[model samples]
Target: MYTTLLHQYQLTLSSRNALFDYCETVKPEDLLKPLATINNESMASLLLHVANCYVFWLANSVMQEKHAYFKGDEHLDLTAVRNVYGQVDLLMNEFLNHFKDSLDVPLLITRPDGSQLTRSPFEIFTHAITHEFHHKGQVVNMSRQLGYTPVDTDVVRE
Candidate 1:
């Protein structure tokens, strides 16, 4: 079961890299340009937001690690964005290994608002990755609005 999840996550990374490669081709200025349709969030901002979600859910919330959130404006370039993801990768590895044998075991987590929720490792992992793919689509649309054609970043290819 863990192997299956690992394989799926690997595919997710491949698709993410495809998007990152495309982001490199976008104009530096346009990468930071806020799109009205995307809640006035820039491509760079959206990318950081995706990473932040992982850190928030997986690293901070689930793993009980206190990782500082990545700020979008601070990571204006793809290189800086990549650096943030590098940290994300480390967190992901830790998350997977720590919960490999207990993917379905419910863990109680405290919310920032003093509330509590019980979630399994599998559910948290699923939520984080699916949230990522959802935002990936938004980022692609944002790129399209910036006059660049989208690339093929799906896990399955024709």
Candidate 2:
């Protein structure tokens, strides 16, 4: 199960990279243009949100490590986004390796509202991936609305 889960994580990375590549096709100034349709979030903000989720779950919750993502990420370009992804990937790999033996062990994660929820590392990882996938759809929609059609990121046949 650990190995399979690890494969899934890697595949998710590939799926996400497809979107990041699409981001590169956007005009530099337009990256931060707020899409009035989709929650008013810019393209960069959505990507940053996805990256931050990985850090929050893998680094903060499970590994008890620190993460650094800035609120001014709308200024970040595709290259900077790639750099952030590199850091996040490193942290996630560490988290997976460290918690391989404790997939079912309940971990107490404190929410923003001060509530604590107990979940296993496996569950947390699954949640993080799904969260990103959900937002990826939004990113796609925003890009299309902006006239940039992104490549298919679905993992079904990729």
Candidate 3:
């Protein structure tokens, strides 16, 4: 079961990479284009937001480690986003290495609103992965609004 969960998480990561690759093809000037989203978050902000969610859940909340993921503005270019992605990727590896054996153990996970809930490591892992895919869809929509078409990043893609 743990291996299966890990596999699912890896699939999410793979798809995320594909999404980033597609985004990289976007023109540099388009990176900060304001999307029609409610909050007016640009493509770069959306990307950075997704990237920071990983660090927030895995490093800040789950592992209880002080890992920082973002080092640039929301209008950051794709290259800066890529740099932050590498940092968050390393933090995720550390998160998995530290908690892989504790999948079934209950840990206090915190929500974005500062509320806390107790959940197993596996559950939290699944949430984080799904959360990324959910936001990825939003990113794809935003990309379309910015005049770029993104390929499918679904886990089941052939």
Q: Which ten residues in a row have the lowest lDDT in candidate 2?
A: 66-75
Q: How does each model score on lDDT?
A: 0.91, 0.82, 0.76
In candidate 2, stretches whose alpha carbon ends up further than 4 angstroms from where it belongs are 73-75
lDDT of 2: 0.82
RMSD of each: 1.0, 1.7, 2.3
TM-score of 1: 0.96
Stretches of candidate 1 exceeding 4 Å from the true structure: none
Deviation from native of the Cα of residue 25 in model 3, angstroms: 2.0
Residue-wise C-alpha lDDT for candidate 3, range 9-126, written one tens digit per residue: 6787789788888888888777677765737777777778877888888878888777666744643787778778777677767766777788889998777688998988777677
Deviation of model 2 at 149, angstroms: 2.3
- How many clashes in each structure? 0, 0, 0
Worst 10 residues of 3 by lDDT: 66-75
Deviation (Å) of 14 in candidate 2: 1.3
Ranking by lDDT: 1, 2, 3
Any runs in candidate 3 off by more than 4 Å, and if so which? 110-114
Which candidate number has the best lDDT?
Answer: 1
Looking at model 2, residue 25 earns an lDDT score of 83
Which is the winner by TM-score between candidate 1 and candidate 2? 1
